[model samples]
Target: MHNTALQSWGDSFRAFVHPRVITMLFMGLSAGIPILLIFSTLSIWLREAGVERSTVTYFSWAALGYSFKFVWAPLIDRLPFPVLYGLLGRRRSWLIIAQTGIIGAILWMGFTDPAQNLTMMAFAAVALGFASATQDIVIDAYRIEAADADLQAMMSSAYIGGYRIGMIVAGAGALTIAGLFEAEGSYEPMAWTVAYGCMALAMGIGVITTLIIGEPTVTRTDSKYFHETSDYVRFLLMFALTVIAFIAANIYTANLTNPLKSGLIDAGMISELAGFIAGTLKLAISVAAAILTAWLTTKVGVTPTGMVQETYIAPVKDFIDRYGKAAIVVLTLIGVYRIADIVMGVMANVFYTDLGFSKEEIATVSKTFGLFMTIAGSFLGGLLSVRYGVVRILFLGALLSAITNILFAIMAHLGPNTMMFAGVIAADNLSGGLATAAFIAYLSGLTNISFTAMQYAIFSSIMTLFPKILAGFSGTVVDSVGYSWFFIGTAIIGIPVLFLVVLAGRMMQINADKQAEIETKT
Candidate 1:
């Protein structure tokens, strides 16, 4: 027993030093840097430049590419780059291209002054989001393909560790650089420009890593979807038409819903609820547009029947076939799992600023110090999941995650108390790290290795879609009810997630038992 335990510990420690696992660290850093620049960190920049809170929140939509990347994930999965594919192979070729896009987008954002031209800044941000989301798709696929099943947990941990470190650089590192450049009580556009320039240069780490790493040998399942040149052209055209239709429908729906949303808010409905209804209405419209586009494409023979179905629909069908009726429940759980964290998080930097914390202070406590706390929580969560099982730890994580938001509510009432602020940051990040680790493990388990890229992308994209859409209205909620009530409301919203977790656990257990029985019969 002693020897067995000692060997287990030794094996675990050695996994981190594996070359592929180490490569994920750099890949994760590359993936992590651009996100905060597009969202939370960008919020601080806008707010400081005197952009309206609602407008600042609206900028969150720029990162909507993250939620929708699944739309093009199939292309990344199967489509190969022309020259780069031959030189660097499939995964690295996409990695380099995506990284290059990230660098260019960050530089573009640095040059555009949000105060002078918010529209241009929004455009740049959208570009950055697209590039970053594409990088994520490629990196996720690479992570899955680069190693065997046993190494995945370690790879995920390494990726997340590196990702958080990248966040620290983008968050704390960027803020510190900006603070150093800008004088007190003055907004110097040049300060942010220089800061962002440095960040753009930092993307070289990813580029260099991609150049160094060898491509994983992926054994793609034979697909009849992309055999002919006409097929590729047809797929691209159909994808474009579908996207245009969705965007058009979303715009039309928003125009129709805006008046109703205003009326509800005027009639004593909460702004958060109203905004949520508007977003849901828009989502429904957009989904309908996509379905219509798919149907029309088939009718017109833009692509052969089952071409789109084979590329996009098949991964989803694989999931549905595996889970059957419980797929809906599982998907619902995925969609809502991160709501409490993301909604409250979208406003965290703004909240600190509102409480009169300096950017330096926020960077130090929230970004730098809090990062270590989160790492600790991640390690602890991983360890506990092994001991207590994933489902139980997942439930505990959900409870802790929801409960920690109340700490934020309490801190809001306390008002700019640094000690209280630090404590709250610690608790929030710890729970966030714990919840995220288990949730990712759960997501990783759901993917069919055959559809590693697309299936995982679908899972991740759905994970963020609803939460991000609702998060865009965070400023409206805070503006309506103030920070205390806003935090409390976020906590309240998480209550249903706990019930969903319980249901999912039972569902998985029953399925496992049935599978075990079938094996026994066999």
Candidate 2:
């Protein structure tokens, strides 16, 4: 039996070399090109243009597009394009459309001047974010659907390889390109714009990949009929939640640093702490609403297998039914897992720039060197997952993840030494790469294969939202407390993730035992 298992594994591993599987690399590239451009790369540009740290960090809000992509994942899975659908098929057609949108948006952003018209630049960033997120939904679904279970892991690795390459281009390559275009005396927006245009052109790799690849053969399983009474109730519940989320977002935005810090903010008769008022209220209301909605499903005699599937227009039900109440704890861990890294990510380039490192230094030492480290870390992460089990590796990665930032805090005190910077970058990327691999594995394990696209999108979206939200306030924190203290805060944020990961492991064991008992009885 062991020999049989070994042979099966060998065959599946060898199949990873198939040309169809390798194509995910370029698709991954197409998926990756815009991320750093709109994120850390763009943050670098904003800082150069004299944008305040607060506003620069708020621009991280554009990342909110990724956090909410589950909203559109279902449509991407099921919807076909008007003209392109017949020509390219369901997946390719959507890919082409989104790729085109990315090209256009990146061009628009390239032409816009950040210093003169920050709002328009922000608009450009948001548009780019939306297009990128749409493309990601299609790409993720395509990756999952195109491969069998054994091959899916290989495909995911290839996709990430391509993704890291794209990051290299948009992050390091963009900076280097812009550094070249910078005039002798002053920083140049035109130089950065020109760099963006190049990124838009590189998207052709994806466009070509889509046109060449065959679409996955897919069939729908669930009859997502909206007319059903239970469906209607679920729809109303999700709609109400959506509205509540929208209101909560606006309230949070109005007082972005601390939402309830305003004089008027309150929860019934309970007045809260002075700080984090708005953010706190937003969290409390959103959580309360979610709990109430979940309870309502029970009271209304809903099966809740896919309670909000039809409403959110995603396959959330498959996951909900599988995990039941455990989903909250699972999701909470996911949400906070990367806060240690992501909250600090927004300020990295800015921190480098402030520390008197030129863009050239950042591109070469930080991005380029860090890319190699990240790749190494990624490979190591996969190996560690195999040997130690994914959950155990995850806790170790989280520990390394938190500790790595303390290196940055030390760097903050030491300030701008190139050797020290390289060490920090190496540690940072290694831990980041390790944690990312483990986290993706964890999320993949939880997804139902049939609902892979929507469910995975939901997980990825939640994983990103928390960190981005916290990162948005990072500038405020830095301004109030300074970078060293801010890094310290970011490091401490991971403490909760570590604890939750431990709890999640325990919960997962209980669930596994329950499944085992039921199987034994049957």
List pairs with backbone clashes in candidate 2.
259-278, 260-277, 260-278, 306-317
Candidate 2 regions exceeding 4 Å error are 1-21, 39-60, 83-89, 111-123, 148-154, 175-194, 217-222, 226-275, 279-309, 343-363, 383-389, 403-417, 466-506, 509-522
* lDDT, candidates in the order shown: 0.84, 0.76
TM-scores of the models, in the order given: 0.84, 0.72
lDDT of 1 by residue, 316-369 (tens): 998998877778889999999999999999999999999889988997899778
Candidate 2 is scored at a TM of: 0.72
CA RMSD (A), model 2:
6.6
Every model's Cα RMSD, please? 4.3, 6.6
lDDT minimum window of 10 residues, candidate 2: 1-10
